[model samples]
Target: MHIQMNDIYKAFGANQVLTGVHFDLKEGEVHALMGENGAGKSTMMNILTGLHKRDSGKIVIDGEERYFDNPKEAEKHGIAFIHQELNVWPDMTVLDNLFIGKELRSPFGLLKTKEMKALAKKQFDKLAVTIPLEKEAGLCSVGEQQMIEIAKALMTNAKVIIMDEPTAALTEREIEKLFNVINALRKEGVSIVYISHRMEEIFAICDRITVMRDGKTVDTQMVSETSFDEVVRKMVGRELTDRYPERNPNIGDTILEVKNATRQGVFEDVNFSVKSGEIVGVAGLMGAGRTEIMRALFGLDQLDSGEILINGQKASIKNPFEAVKRGIGFITEDRKNEGLVLDFSIRENMALPNLTSFSKNGFIAYKTETDFVDMLIKRLRIKTESGETSAKNLSGGNQQKVVIAKWVGIGPRVLILDEPTRGVDVGAKREIYQLMNELTDRGVAIIMVSSELPEVLGMSDRILVVHEGKISGELLKNEATQEKIMTYATGGQ
Candidate 1:
């Protein structure tokens, strides 16, 4: 199947999201969509998937023009979308989830449970994964859940599939399996629209690349014809000379110190010290205690035994509020649930942390709140319609910025960021790095937990690898590498 989108234009109120963007898909090939945060990639895909109606555009499928009213209508034309966010319910079985809305029923008004299980099993087998058909979907790991999502797409007999940030939460082994599945699907002549922020994945799997910037389609070139440097330049609308911003962290006195931090069945005997103006990067696999350590330090989790010292003096944090008062800020891994109130306006979300600073005698100061919100929006380069817009309306990258802005407003002596650039694009990532550079330059200590080894190697003054609830090894910035980190992460040390 061949699909073409010409001169797509869309807007919401005063903001023009997509302007004269053009995209097309070829049969049996994986097409990569690359862009910075708020570059209109999602907006364009939303229009293509029938989630939004284009204000002006033409969609031609196999030389026939068509317009879909909704996602269901689009599905009838053999389009399937496996979103980055897992849509499966925790309590529901894999069999039930795979055939939830579209079930296999007998003509006599009876459901075919056996057949549903068998069909789902078949899909899993093809992907070389064994899934208990009756097992609850939520009980599965993030990687298995991702495979289940792909199986659901195959159940639809989709000719064209869109995978958005499919490997954001997948492990190294899980990622390899996903690539194999993609290859098998391509062999069967299925078209795939692969959207991701990882440059390696684009060059590895995608045949054609399309770059968008500021709601416009910039360029689409063959993977073999372009270099990573060129793709990044076009996506960000300028040459990015450095992937990681230059930082000469002025290592000062130890600001935060952890002594024998232990959490039962989570992490144990974790010891580290973050000096002022230093970025300590934690590198580990999923469930390896990186986030667990941070949680314990930030007062989000109970510690079996630990001692926290701030400014070389013992400090006790019984709760998050106490941690905040003690000059500690945490950016949680789960942004949607733990970080932001989706329904709240940007104005409320950004100012939620500093209400005391912007208020007096329990009376909120509207002017002070607005002034601070405006400053953060500008400082973080957050793209939004207005400060009044809901946080849910922003892109994933921009949503992350809101979380950062909220914490940065608290003026913490030490900041802990978990998966800081998980799903954000390259351009926004550079901006975040710059922000970190500026923060460290201001003499604040930062502890970042990330699964991306390259990111850990690039930004950290030091890298700590965790393996099975223990700090396996620690490496200075010059000594850390992907192989060295994995050696420790896999319990080698």
Candidate 2:
């Protein structure tokens, strides 16, 4: 089947989100939708999926016009969406979440729990995963939650599957497994609409790519005919030669040190140090204790036995408040749950950790709080309607910027970034890299944990490889290679 979206025009108040945008997906083909944050990609997709009614558009499925009033209507027509943010309840079991809206019910108005559980098992088996169906969805890791979302889509027997950043939280192994599943779906004549900021994944998995820019359809072309740089240029409206900002060579004395850091079953005996003005990239396969170490250092988790010294003086940190007081900040990987407050405004979230700076008489100084947030928004280039806008309203990239802006406003001496660019676009990633450079130039040390090898190799002054909850090896900037890092990451050291 071929799906055609023609003359799609949508508007929110005075903002014209999509101006005559168009997209197409062919049968059994992986079609990629590429654009920068707030480039109208999501708006266009929302229209197609029936989450929002289009002001003007024609959706043609195999020459027949279709208009879906709601998401259930779209799903009934074999169209399914796996949203960027995970949509599973922590309180519900995996089985319940998988069959949430489309539960199997008996004719007598009773819930058919056993049949739904059995059906969930079948889908998991097809996906080659073994998640405990009875376990709470919240207990599962982010990667597992992602897997459950995919399985939920499959339960609808969807002919057209829309995946928005499906692999953003997945490990290398999980990504491979997901790719295998996608390949299997293609063989069965299922079409895919893949939206992601990762260029490599688009080149590897997609057949055609549709580029959108500033609420307009820029171009649609085959993957084999176009280049990655050309696509990036189309999205950002500029030529980006250097994917990462040039590294600053100025290094100084160690600013933060963790000696013999241990967190029991989480990690063991970790030893590392970050120098002032240095960007230390931590690399390892998933579950290699990289995140755990950062968490412990940030006082999110208490180290079972370890010594943390800041600038040659031993420091005691019992919680995040203490960590912040000690001039340390962490930009967590799970931004939605850990790094941001969805209900709070952009300025409100920024004012959270640094409220003391804006208060003198126990009452918040709204003007001071907004001024600080405004400055950071400008410095970080965060795209928002206003500082009063809710954090949830901003795009993924902008939300990430807000998180950084909050920490930077606090003036942390040492910043810990966990997957800083996991789901952001190329333009945002480059901008963030530049921000990192600026921070380091100001003598603020940074410890970055990343799963992307190229990002680590390009931006870091040094690399630390972790394996099985241990610091397996360390490599200088010039000496580190993907192969060498992999060797150490797999316990070669």
| Best-performing candidate as measured by TM-score | 2
Misplaced by over 4 Å in model 1 are 91-95, 105-115, 125-147
* Candidate 2 lDDT by residue in tens digits, 1-493: 6899999999877677889999989999999999998888877878887898898979999899988888889899899999888888999999889988777888998899998888888888888888899999998877789999999998899999999999988877778889999999999999999999989999999999999988899999999999999999999999998898778568999999989999999789999999999999999987788888898888888988989999999999888999999999999988899999999999999999899999988988888888888999888878777898899978777888888888988888999999999878899899899989989999999999998889999999999999989999999999999999989998885
- Among all candidates shown, the one with the greatest lDDT: 2
List the candidates' TM-scores in order.
0.94, 0.95
Q: Please, what are the lDDT tens digits per residue for candidate 1 over residues 1-493?
A: 8999999999988899999999999999999998988888888878888899999989999999988888888887899988766788879998888888899889997998888878887888877768798899877766578778888988899999999888887767667778998998899999999999999999999999999999999999899999989999898878989899888889999999999999888788999999999999998887687887898888988889989999989988878999999989999877776889999999999898788998899899899899899999999889997799999889888889999999999998999999888779998899899999999999999999987888888999999888999999999998778999989988896
TM-score of 2: 0.95
| Clash tally for model 2 | 0
The 10-residue segment with the lowest total lDDT in model 2: 241-250
Which residue runs does candidate 2 get wrong by more than 4 Å? 105-118
